[model samples]
Target: MEKTTKHPKQSFTVMNELVLPNDTNTLNNLMGGRLLHWMDIAAAISAQKHSNRIVVTASVDNVSFKQAIKLGDVITIEALVTRAFNTSMEVRLDVWAENIPSGTRHKSNEAFYTFVALDENGKTVPIPEIVPETAEEQELYDGALRRRQLRLVLGGKMQAKDANELRAIFYKD
Candidate 1:
């Protein structure tokens, strides 16, 4: 059977949520854990869209909270599948905090999440390939492999020498 494919835009997901007092921390800003929860939900939606199967988060890459989202702020999270590798895929999420009074939005954070599709029996299942339309999408797609390799190496799943793209970063002359 021919493998299916989907465009990055086809998996694009945007989610917006209001930050309530319950979602705030002692400083009255949105809690980091709460934001991460929202990001995970948004990323899972994008992953499922691209794979058309049940997906679970495998890992979440560096998440730096650049700005504090205050209570009553609207947090908008945008996610897209950057690439798919067999059963696993990478989803990039962008978060923005919007102030209702000022009607302004600022980038709060960004991160990459990895998800794996599963069959009904919970076994890993192959997913469709991803097609990139724009230059930015293509760049991300091309770099996904390198990122995956690095993650595998860091997690002790793969040896450093086996990480081709990651090895090139340090061994390049």
Candidate 2:
């Protein structure tokens, strides 16, 4: 069967959660693990939307918690599939925290997650190609290759010298 092409906007996903007491640490800020869990789920949904198949998280890039989310604050997570390659796709997620009482909102952090689509039999499956519409989406689409190469090198799956895109940036000849 021929695979279809999907626009990045078509796979956009937004998730919101309330920072409850149980979700906070002793300092009353939302625990980093809890936030990571939320991000994983949101990114998975976006990947699934793009693939239309069972998606499993392949890897998560580093995530830095720059802002603290206090109890009762609303945490919003937005995810979009930036690029699709064969069976794997890269999802970008942006996190924001909002204080209802004070009517303030600020960026918490951003992260990249890689997901692979699977068939019902549990084997890897090819996903639809990503069609970036906006300029920002196009830019992200272009950068996804370099990011994936970096991750592969860092994970030891690929040698640093084999990362052509990344090598070009630092090792110009």
Candidate 3:
């Protein structure tokens, strides 16, 4: 799963504001929904750079909130396109939160998101082929391939009813 890259071809940036009292539920912590929204935005930016077209979230792989982000902590999201398929790209995002007063930073979350390039009519469109320029980039590409395989397996095992339900959640008109 590793390919060598001399340099990175594409990159995208996403900024997240700190959690506020209003942004939190009664737990005094950031809500999962809010974090997901930020991740979606960051993934879209990365996917658009790889495709050079409008992109929509096809699915989100496993997302784990490893640490809690508190109020006054700035969350910075960095996303890179690790792999590309015929009409889809896999973006890996690193979510880090920085405390303003102390300048301390910590990784709060990470996730892989699948995005498909879209045409004006909302059909799938082709995306550029990703060529790894560095060893790290190649490793990321390879890891994405493995993840895609896992996703396929999971997709295949879904019961008809559950598959339909998942489709409904993702493809609502």
Off by over 4 Å in 1: 1-10
List, residue by residue over 100-167, the lDDT tens digit for candidate 2: 99999999999999999999999999988978888999999999999999999999999998999998
Clashing pairs in model 2, backbone N/Cα/C closer than 3 A? none
Best to worst by TM-score, what's the order? 2, 1, 3
Question: Candidate 3, after superposition: displacement of residue 94 in Å?
Answer: 0.6
Error of 2 at 66 (Å): 0.7
Pitting candidate 2 against candidate 3, the one with the higher lDDT is 2
Worst lDDT run of 10 residues, candidate 1, spans: 1-10
Candidate 1: the clashing residue pairs are: none
Candidate 3 lDDT over residue span 1-173, tens digit each: 11212224655556566667877767677788998988888788778866779999888998988988887678788778888989988988888989889989999899999999999999998878888888998988877766766676587854444444345545876
TM-score on alpha carbons, each prediction: 0.93, 0.93, 0.82
lDDT (Cα, tens digit) per residue for candidate 1, span 1-173: 01223454548888889999999989999999999999999999889978889999999999998989999999889888999998999999999999999999999999999999999999999998888888999999988999999889889999988998887878976
Q: What is the Cα-based lDDT of residue 165 in candidate 2? A: 96
- The TM-score between candidate 1 and the true structure equals 0.93
In model 3, what lDDT does residue 126 have? 86
